[model samples]
Target: MSLIAAASFFGWLVGPLAGGYLAQYGAAMAFQVAAVAVFLCMIFVATVIKETHKVSNEQSFLSLFKSNNSLTLLSHPNILNLFVLQFFSVLV
Candidate 1:
């Protein structure tokens, strides 16, 4: 968790520096560069990464939302209480 937090913090810190460097060229060029970088990353992930988890034939991903299962889960007392707390916290 700490590693994730640190990485996220550093990413936020460095992102502006990268943008600032790119902005010296032009806003349009900066946007194009960012777009190309994202495209390259997507391609790399799609080609290089393999899925490890095998899904059972019987269990579909939509099983969680089938019937009233999703509603039933959300309507639990503990979940309702958490929702209420979150609402109040955000309201404040």
Candidate 2:
């Protein structure tokens, strides 16, 4: 978790600087670079990342979105705090 957080922090820190440099080439070029990066990330996840947990065949995908499970998660203090933080961050 610490490594993940550190990596995320560094990514956020560097993203703006990298984007500013890329933008000098042109807005379209910057967007194209971003799109290619996203495509490569998708490909990496699809091929390199392996699923460790066996998903139960019985559960429909929609079951994952059931309100009861969501409410249960929100009932936790830590989760609720995180939710609120994310909500306000998006507003900003």
Candidate 3:
């Protein structure tokens, strides 16, 4: 799973350089190819991917970012405090 994730990220990372070169060569099919490649990625995720956690429910995007779920013992509180303090310090 980790390897697959890494490879997917690597492909995304290099995609623009490859596509730009292909477009300069006037292959014209370059954008279509990239779109198809993305579609194929969706298929791969649907069929081959499994949840990493043993038990996990998918969360909504807004809820994921907005949740107070980060309040915590190991790391969250002071980190958030420092972050908020930085924001105020910058504004002041």
Candidate 4:
């Protein structure tokens, strides 16, 4: 957990510097580089990452979006409070 936090800290620290350097070429070049990096990361995750959770084959993907599931989560007091807070915050 500490290693992950440290890596995330360094990533935030260096990202702007790297982006600024890349921006010297052009704003479009910087965006293109970012897009390519995201694509490569996606590819790496798809190929190299192992799934830890065992998903039931019987469950259809659409079932995951059922209203009951959403309502159940919102039934929790803290989560519901946070949800309302977020909703009002956006309007402000």
Q: In order, how many clashes per candidate?
A: 0, 0, 0, 0
My TM-score estimates for the predictions, one after another, are 0.64, 0.63, 0.50, 0.56
- The residue-by-residue lDDT of candidate 1 on 1-92, one tens digit each, is 99989978987887678889999898887788878877997999899999899856666657745843755666689998888898899999
Write the candidate numbers in order of decreasing lDDT. Answer: 4, 2, 1, 3
The per-prediction CA RMSD against the true structure, in angstroms, equals 3.5, 5.0, 5.5, 3.9
C-alpha RMSD between model 1 and the true structure:
3.5
What C-alpha lDDT does candidate 1 achieve relative to the native structure? 0.80
- How accurate locally, in lDDT, is each candidate? 0.80, 0.84, 0.79, 0.85
TM-score of 3: 0.50
lDDT, residue 46, model 4: 94
lDDT minimum window of 10 residues, candidate 3: 65-74
Off by over 4 Å in 4: 1-9, 60-62, 67-92
TM match of model 2 to true structure:
0.63
Name the Cα RMSD for model 4.
3.9
* lDDT value, residue 2 of candidate 2: 100
Off by over 4 Å in 2: 61-63, 73-92
lDDT by residue (17-87, candidate 2, tens digit) is 77899988988887788788789989999999999999666767677668436677888899999999999
Candidate with better lDDT, 2 vs 3: 2
Tell me which residue pairs clash in candidate 1. none
lDDT of 4: 0.85
